[model samples]
Target: MALAAVVAVTALLVSYREVALSADGLRSQAAPAVQDVAATRLALLRADWEANWVKENLNGVPAAGESYQSQLSAADQSLSRLAERTSDDLGTINGLLDSYGTSITDGALYYHDDRPIQDQKFREAGSLLIRSDVGLVPRLDKLQNGQMDRAERLATMGALGYTGWVVAELALLVLALTLLSALWVLRDRCGRDYNPWLLSSLVLTVALAVVPLLAMTVTQRHLDNARDKLTAITTVAKQTERETKVDTTDARVRLDGAQTRVSKTSQEVRKELSAHEWQNSVYYGALGGGILVFLLPATGIGRRLNADYWRAR
Candidate 1:
């Protein structure tokens, strides 16, 4: 039982190691990559918004420059940060960011000065932001999907880890209970009410068993929390991408569909993630608990047989 406890612990520690790494990797890797894409997409969206606003109010020149400039400046900061981190390896993405920023900046400038942007020029900047997006969006999609994939894998491993914990704890529990029962039986059979060594062993076994059970309860809660949050964020981001990065063929239609799906889809995804987390934890408990209940006596029997064989030899 002690050896089994060690194995169970090792399995859990090794398996859930990736959970921490996944969180870190998403922040360090996926965040930068995907945020760049998102920022560019937002720039595209904003540029389009600016163009549309101008065309609608060309004669009036409405007082929207402050809000529009604020958005552009914020986007510029994001791009500027990306620029500071550029390398040969990041040339593709760097170029895309630069082009996207240029389009947004130029359009904002023309709109700010209230200069007439020729028909092609007005659309050209927005079009470049969109066109440049072609090279970047898919990579961001992959990174986004990859983060969730890692999370799912961790959830599976966490479930398995909890299962192992349960199994080891059950073995220890049964061993403790049987020994405690044997103490009473020995009082009837051999006239000894207690054996100090047996009492000590039983106490130790129960302590060990209880520890894992308690620890696993906490572990399950953490797994549930991380899994649910990651799922919610991933779902929302995916839906947002679908809405914001519409393709040339029916961008409006796709955007509308994506917008419509956001609320319902996010709710459904969150529900599924929550249900899955609960199911995995429950299974971990059941399988671990059942094995302890049904098969633990065999451990006792095997130990006794080994002891007897050594004595006979």
Candidate 2:
């Protein structure tokens, strides 16, 4: 019974640790990486549209030029942040971005003198950004897809961890039953009253079982919420992309709204994940409690048996 109790405790602690790690990966690594890629795509699309507007208007408007530069800067910053989390080689994408910026700058220089050349330059830059196969936007889409896949896998692992928790609970139930049976046998055969040590172990075991289960339940809830938020952000981003083709002003409005949602949801995810930081301490405490639970039963039964042996001698 002591051995069974120890095993159950170890299993529960291990399972809980797995779940915590999965949540951390999703919150700290995968979700943010996805957001970064999405942001990069949106920024690049807006910049492309602004460059075209500049070419068509030929108004020498400072606002349009500034917007274009601002979007490029935003895309660059997003890519830089993504670099920290991803293992993918970004050398090619960075090179393309540099070339794209140069073409845009060169095209602006020819706006007054050579209209056709300026148009050609802008076309080259646009192709670098949204060309069919080699465009920066599509590449970022592929990267974001990879991040989404990773998040899905982590979520699956968390589900499996919960399954492990169920098994641990079953083991705890069996341990409780065994302890009760031992107490009853001692009372009937040896005319012993309820053993204090065994009684305390039973109570402690029940408490331990309930506490971790409650924690797991709460963790699962937070995980689900974070996932839902990520999904919403992705959907909004896609809609913004589609709408950008129809109206630039409307697209800008949608992009701003999406950015706000992303920012708020990201904060919420971090807060939820931070709640599990204390889990390591809880794990150690539960381990120590399991040892105590085992010891209590062993000490009680050992004393009773020793007393009987001495009486026989």
Candidate 3:
């Protein structure tokens, strides 16, 4: 019975740990990487749109140039953040962005001089930004997809871990019942009241079984909420990507709103996952508590056997 209890406790601990780790990875690394990549892509799109708007309108050069610079800065910041978190080599994307910026700047210079080459420069820059192949946008999209894939894998692992936890809980309940039955048998055979040590072990077993179950329930809820928010952000981003032009104020306003929502949802996910801080404490407590539960039952049974041996002697 003691061995069974130990095994059950170990299984519970391992399973719950897996869930916690997966949740942490999803929250801390994968989710954030996805957000960063998406942000970068959005910023680049807006900046290119601004540049194109200026080229076509031949007016609002000051305002449009300011917006373009601001968007490019935003994209740079997002890329820096992404580089810190991701293992992917961002050198290619960075090089492409630099070349794209140069083309846009040259286009502006040509426009100022009324050079015929202004159109060519703008077209080249636009192609570098949005060409279906070997463009900055496509590269970022590839990175974002990879990050999303990682987040999905982590979420799946957490779910599998939850399933494992349920199995462990069932095993623990069975072992607890078996131990209690054995205790009851000993009490009847020896003509004594219930053993205190074994009784305490039963209480500990109940605690070990119940506490983590509740904690895991809460963790799973948070994980699901985070996943939902991330999906919403992805959907919004894809919608924004489909826009052919952002020349009108209304189009630009919509893009701004979408970006704001993505940022807000990302923040909410981080806040929700932060509530998982208690998982580490619960995990360690379960380890110690499980050992004590095992020891108490063994001590109680050993005492009973020793007493019987003396009586026989």
Candidate 4:
């Protein structure tokens, strides 16, 4: 009874610590990418707003004291930061924005007249800005796609934490079979009811199995939270950009809050990922292969060999 209790306690402790550390590492890895996603969406919104400003002011009539020039600038700055970590084609992104900016600026020069007039040059420039604005969204989508791929990979690795459940299950299955075999062997060879070590091993493996299932479940929940928050922020950004009459102050505040949540959750995933040791193939192979070495003797194999020795004698 004491041995079984000890085994259960030890297994629980090991499993809990392993799962917690893995979860932390995962959170840490996802943090930066989540931040980038938020930034990219924000940039897209600003660039579109810049174009909108040009459309509204096509007749040399600026939006009554509203300087709508900084959206694109903010977008450019955000993209520049994201480009450092992402393989996205920065040249294309920056080029599109530059073209839009140049078109709108050059077209405005045609509006030098004091009265409202849709000069041919102004119309052409405004059209060019619109075309560029439309094209920009697709390019931004492409960049976001690339980022999602990387995050998915990281999420998969973080999901490896769930494999602890699988491994523990396998270990339990082995223990179950081994338990049955031990019962047969003990009854035939020594008239014992059960082998204490085999019973202890069963308890230990069962305890280990339970924790990983819970660990993996928790990991999945966090992953979903992080992903949903990111999607919400991006969707909201697109909506804010598309709407012609939005409360800029309120929309901005909501987007900011959503981005903050995304950031927090991403950090949590990266932290879970950092705790895993067998991150690569070689280390995983070594850990798994090493299990067989201890497993054979720790189970009933040793007793079987001893039983054979006495029978031979």
Candidate 5:
């Protein structure tokens, strides 16, 4: 029993370590660096558009302003693609883009009319653009905080898993000692008789050995499957990242590939976990069944009589 306990504890510790490492690896693959860079570029493009809008629209549609707007729209599209790949924060960007578009349209209308621009309307539109850009800073900050929280939680789990391993080891050691002592006592008391007590000890030793082996095999198999899935996703992601870095490099594409890899790996790990749980159920059931089988002969009438007649009283 003590030996069995030790094996169980060791198995559990190994499993925990494997899981924590897998989780940390996944998180590292999905780092937010790509999104951060994309966001910075997007903000810069928006700022440039705003600056030009302020100057060029002061006296109605300057051709230079019109040209800058076209360039701004293209930049916005690039930013939008980045947003699509990384997050849904594009809603904020979209709002800003819409405000900028509306102001441009309004300014064009006034340009056609040759009417003096109403300062209040222009100010309101400008304010909307400013607010839109400012809104992004806060949202990005929130995203950074979220990423930090994720990283911290993962780190804590790793620490806890290591701690759990220590506790499990101690528990297992104690259990093994108890079991060995019990076996020793059984051996001495049942010295010559092939009676129920003797049989029970043999059966227990058999069960203690077999059950853990079965459980360990199943657990190892599960861990292997999880590792394979993680490997496949990583390979795909790495390939994509490499391709994206060719001549006309695009950070957004590279980031998108990395995210895909991490997401797929996480999914596979989760699936393997569910499967491992079912395997655990079967293993425990088998252990219980084996124990019951071992107890049956000891409960027989003949064995009971023999134990009563000759057993150490």
Candidate 6:
């Protein structure tokens, strides 16, 4: 029983460690990579739209012109790929992209004919684009963020699970102690050779080890599956950003004031991601360490006591 306890405790420790490491990997590295890619994509897409605005409102200079058209084509390809990948929310994004394409097409035609856009018309179309953008793009980004939040929440719950395991282990220890005490009373009462404390301790040891180990294994597996899903979402975001970047570049011209604003907004998003990653990493690390520390004594003492009982009996 004592040996079983030791084994169980060891298993618990290993499980918690794996979960912690995985969380750290996600918060410190994986999550940030995903956010960075998404933010970059958002920035580029906004830039493209801003250029469209500038071409319309600014001195008859079309921001993207032929280059912008080429970029839009690439964007179309990217959006198509995204639609293929995201089987779940394809409809919303596809519709938004279609609307965006139409707007771009109309805006480009107006620019080609050198037709001065009325401020009101520009505002209306711009509002439509904004509606399409905030409606779709941010939601996509939010989905990714939502995964991260879930992971963080799971990690927190895992800690709580660890605490429960600790209590179970302690209970096993107490039970073992009670058994050992009973053995002593038996020997005294019957004039027999029995060590109740030792026998009881053995049971406690097993309980301590088995319960925590099992709980940890199950929880870690859950975390692993969740993290994998998060990673998949990240991959999609990265692919989209890479495709967009292939066709986007900074031009020497101001193009549109809106583009500048988008750049500023993108920068803000980048900063937010950085901060989020840092916060996640720190908290996750602390939780992981706490689990490990809590598990060690609970398992070890029980195992040791059980071993002594077995040897005496």
Scored by TM-score, the top model is 3
Query: Residue by residue across 184-254, what tens digits does model 1's lDDT show?
Result: 76567656546554555565455445643554455545555555655655455466555555544554444
Q: lDDT (0-100) at residue 215 of candidate 2?
A: 75
Considering lDDT, where higher is better, how would the candidates rank from best to worst? 3, 2, 4, 1, 6, 5
**Candidate 6: which stretches are off by over 4 Å?**
2-37, 48-50, 53-63, 66-88, 114-125, 132-134, 137-145, 164-313
Superposition error at 275 for model 2 (Å): 2.3
Please list the C-alpha lDDT of all candidates, in the order they appear.
0.49, 0.79, 0.82, 0.51, 0.47, 0.49
As a TM-score, model 4 comes out at 0.58
For candidate 1, the 10 contiguous residues with the lowest summed lDDT are: 270-279
Off by over 4 Å in 5: 1-138, 155-158, 189-313
**Candidates' RMSD to native:** 9.0, 2.3, 2.2, 8.0, 10.7, 11.5
What does candidate 5's lDDT look like per residue over 1-313, in tens digits? 4344445445553544455454433333323323332334343333333444444445553543554365346546645554544544667656755675566556543443444453444554555543443743344445445543443343333565556545544544454455445445545764533445434544554554455445545555555655455445434444543454363245444544454455566566666545444444544554554454334434543465566689656
lDDT of 4: 0.51
For model 2, what is the error of residue 181's alpha carbon versus the real structure, in angstroms, after optimal superposition?
A: 1.2
Worst 10 residues of 4 by lDDT: 278-287
lDDT of 4 by residue, 1-313 (tens): 2333334334433444554443443354334544665565554454444444454555446452133355556556776776666655678667766776565445444444632442444454444334453566666766666665655554444444445445545555565565667667777876666666566555545544554455546655565555555555456545655553356555445554544554565455455444444323322332343343236335555776587699879
Model 3 TM-score, all chains together: 0.92
The residue pairs that clash in candidate 2, if any, are: none
User: What TM-score would each prediction reach against the true structure?
Assistant: 0.53, 0.90, 0.92, 0.58, 0.38, 0.41
Q: Of models 2 and 6, which has the larger lDDT?
A: 2
